[model samples]
Target: MQRFPFRFAPAYRLPALLFGVTPGTARVEVDDTELRARFGPWSLRTPLTNVASVERTGGFQFLKTAGPAHLSFADHGVTFATNGDDAVCVCFHEPVRVLDPTGRLRHPGATFTVADPPALLAALEDLEER
Candidate 1:
């Protein structure tokens, strides 16, 4: 049994809820958090170790996570891995993107290859608007 500690602000609750995920599901204690999220039908879980925090700016909230690592979004039905240091990966359902630290698009369309936090934040902003 493995336990991962994560902190999600109240703002993100809506997005999680929209995806049919409650706090209980988000804050789960399981053997493999990533695996559980991947196999689960309607849940999106990222390893706490991979995630840093959610950044909010200009009426938008973004889920930010460190990249160069594997990630899964069951609701979005996407699974992919990144390999970059200052890369930030953003997954809004099926659409996933990666950005560099300066907030420039490293990779767009289909798959992402960078992991910059600023880029991730930008994507989050876009999602928040939707």
Candidate 2:
């Protein structure tokens, strides 16, 4: 698997915690057939074909409007972060269950932020084209 890592500044610690996200570090992993996100102690993985759309968004603004899907650190499919830098929002063809630290399905979908918006967006676009 290939991984792209990002560390949030932890500026939104309180808000992140409110959304159940610890807000520190995160990574996006992609392979021939699937894509996954690992945030703090939570993770979400699904088939590459499951992705319906990928778009850039205001890191903090998006988080404010994004709804919380679980109590294990994800809001509106996004993994929380301290700042909105390099944020990429993803939509899936269907809900992909999110697993909290305990490995329980607390939410679904794969919306989150990465360190590099352009790189992540490009990768997703490539996947969609394929």
Candidate 3:
């Protein structure tokens, strides 16, 4: 199996109970061409061979990329991976925070809030342009 050269922490703050130390990185793949186009070039930067699975719950969607790890994000609510494998789920409440097992800040806080997907997408697009 191929390995990624860089490490990745949750770009957004996931609930403490969901995240843990030893965060893993997965190669981003373009399984859905339409979705990739919608997401734009930023999606290309992701490793294309590592995507494991993608799922949606009440208001959130969990993306389980390669490396058998998971990532959580919120759209209308809180969406994240429930297990270490490729299983995503949505929740009604926001996650606690993205911290290691010891509770340390991993990635920076998200600029856009989960409640607003359009704004968040716009902000993400803006960030990509920068």
Q: Distance from true position, residue 36, model 2, in Å?
A: 1.0
Off by over 4 Å in 1: 27-35, 38-130
> Top TM-score: which candidate number?
2
- Which structure is stronger by lDDT: 2 or 3? 2
State the lDDT of candidate 1 residue by residue for 71-125, as single tens digits: 3342321322222222223333222232223433222211222223454445434
lDDT of 2 by residue, 29-49 (tens): 888898877665556788999
In order, the Cα lDDT scores of the candidates are 0.31, 0.62, 0.25
Q: For every model shown, what is its TM-score relative to the native structure?
A: 0.28, 0.68, 0.22
How big is the RMSD of model 3? 15.2
Q: Where's the lowest-lDDT run of ten residues in candidate 2?
A: 65-74
Model 3: residue 113 alpha-carbon error in angstroms = 6.9
Error of 1 at 74 (Å): 17
Q: What is candidate 3's CA lDDT for residue 22?
A: 26
